[model samples]
Target: MTVTLAQAINRGIHDAMEADDRVLMFGEDVGKLGGVFRVTDTLQETFGTDRVYDTPLAESGIIGTAIGLAMYGFRPVAEMQFDGFAYPAFEQFTSHLAKMRNRSRGRVKLPVTVRIPFGGGIGAVEHHSESPETYWAHTAGLKVVSPGTVADGYAMTRAAIAADDPVIVLEPKRRYWMKDDLELPVTTEPLHKAVVRRPGTDVTVVAYGPMLKTAMEAADAAEEEGWSLEVVDLRSLSPIDTDTLVASLQRTGRMVVVHEAAQSLGPAAEIAARMQQEAFYHLEAPILRATGYDTPYPPAMLEEFWLPDVDRILDRVEEALDY
Candidate 1:
């Protein structure tokens, strides 16, 4: 069936709730309103208010409640509504949700999934569009995963919900309506493994979430220019499938990292450092980054200039090939 990224995620949540009565979903407007994006539509009606309900307009409280429910053996799935809003709950994520397992010396398990709609492309307001995955990826005890396609959206959401450890699912809000035809209950690679979306030999472009689409577009453009570009989707950010990345780099011999987040201290930086450390001899040129500037997310009108696009990605790819 043809399913959109948003609908795929809704089905994933629905299936999880159906399979496990212990699974619960709650967030602002998630119950009756079905979420601002309608990703949670019909869930409340299907499961009723007992398991699927709405919470106050407090990000911290939502996360805190999820943590408590998790401690009590309930696998709570909390939604942060937007990317920037998750900052208010950073304390709960780092100090409590992430540390609980270790603090209890392996006796406590927090099977909590925090869903965040992230990235900039919908011409949203400042706080509405922000890439905060870096913060969650940097946290030690959390698993971070993002899906670029409709199938991965459903598969990754299910994996995140079933994981015993805390997980942060970064949904690419810009691609919510992006659709594809696929069967239900689709399962791909393991949650932490990266996959090569397009194979090429000239250079490897590594990206995830919203940037995956941009990278694939760049690869298509590069083919017309006589450059074979390999696009790798880093599905899981925290654990980072380094082996897959290194193998791609060894074959391609050149690499360019792309992301919507600011270049400084972003996921690109970590990937570049790891590639150099593990496969420096295989690199044909210095790792280049096509990303946003260090400045805060630009206003809606100026976001076009701030966010990375196919042109920027190709520019970096050309530079890498030229070297």
Candidate 2:
């Protein structure tokens, strides 16, 4: 069956709630309004107010409460309405949610999933379109992941909810409407692994979430220009599947990391550093990145120039090939 990425996520939440009595979701506008993106549409109605409901307009309060709920054996999914809005909850997440399991010496399990709709391309307001995955991914004890495809959106959400550790699921706001013909209960791909979406030998392009499709599109377009680009999706930001990435680099000998976030100090920087350390001998060219400008997410009118797009990715691919 064909389903949009948003629908796939909705299905994932439905399956999760049905599978576990302890699985519950809460966030701003998630109850009657069905989330700002409607990804939680009809879920509150199906699961009832007890299992799926709304919370006050407080990101820190929402996450702080989820941590307590997790301690009580409830697998809570807390949504941070927008990427920038999640900043207020950083203290609760890093201090408590990400530390409880270790603080208790493995006696406590934090089955909390913090779902964030992140990245830009929708030309929305500043705060509504920020890519902040690097913040959570860098935090210790937090397993950070972002889904690129419809299947991953379904499977990874379930995987995050089932795990005993805290998981941050960053959904690409721009790619939510992307549709694919994958059925529910999708492929059993591990949440922490990076997968090759397209194969080639000339160059490797690494991306995830909002930038995955753009990378793939650039790869396809590169073929007509007589270049072969392999696209790898880094599904898990933290604990990146470096083996998969290094293996691809071993074959291609060149790579370009792309993301919607700023290039400096973002996930791309960490991945590039890892490749330099792990696959330095095999690299034919220095790793390059095509990412958002180092400034604040630009206003909607100028976002096209700020966010990474097909041309930007292609330019990086061409540069990698030229080197």
Candidate 3:
């Protein structure tokens, strides 16, 4: 059955709650309000207020307490109302939840899933459009992932809940309304690997979150101009799907890394570095980057220039091919 990406998340969590009595969720207004974006609508009622409850607006406290609950054998799913609000919990996440099992020499485990609604496009005020994936990806012990499609939204949520380690799942806020008949087999692909959304031969465009949709659109725009673009949705960000990325670059000999993060030290930089190390000889040009400028995400009025649109991606593509 076809469903919007947002609905998939709603249904998927419902399934997870039914599948495991130990699963619980906590966040700001996740109870009666179902979250700031309504992703958790009705979750509290169905799961009972005890299983799905709201917590104080302190991110650190939410995560720190969730870690303890995890130690007690409860699967905790913590939600950050917005991407920018996750900073306060960073210390607790990296220091405790991420290191519990390793510190115990594998004696104990922390099973936690943190759902963050992120990325731009809805056009809101400050602190609403920040992309902080790099900060968490830089963390050592946490598994970071994002879902670009309804199918992935469901599968990744389920997989994260079952993992005995802490996982951060960033849901592209701009894509909640996007829907599709993602009836693909459940076992078709690994949640931690990259997925090829489009096949091509000219160049490889690596993107994640909402940028995945933009990359697909860019591929279509270039198709008429005789350029074939292989669009790869980097589903898993932390343990990057480097193997898939390297193989694709080896074949294309050109690459364009796109993301909504600032240019310096962004995911694009990491990808560019890897491609250079693994496929420098095979490259036809320098790895082109189409990224958010090295400035804070501006007001919605200026985001068109900040976020890489089709024009931006294709402009870089031209430079790469012309090189």
lDDT of 2 by residue, 6-115 (tens): 98999999999999989999999999999989999999999999999899999999999998998888999999999999999989989888888889999988899999
lDDT of 1 by residue, 1-323 (tens): 99899999999999999999999999999999999999999999999999999998999999999989998989999999999999999899999988899999999999999999999999998799899888889988999999998999999999999999999999999999999976965869999999999999999999999999989998988889999999999999989999999999999999999999999999999999999999999988999999999999999999999999999999999899889
Error of 1 at 88 (Å): 1.1
Ranking by TM-score: 1, 2, 3
Using all chains and alpha carbons, the TM-scores for the candidates as numbered come to: 0.99, 0.99, 0.97
| Model 3 ranges with Cα > 4 A deviation | none
Q: What global local distance difference test value does model 2 have?
A: 0.92
**Residue 300 displacement (Å), model 2:** 0.3
Residue-by-residue lDDT tens digits, candidate 3, 203-261:
89999888999999999999988899999899998889888998888889999999988
For residue 67, what is the lDDT in candidate 2?
89
Ranking by lDDT: 1, 2, 3
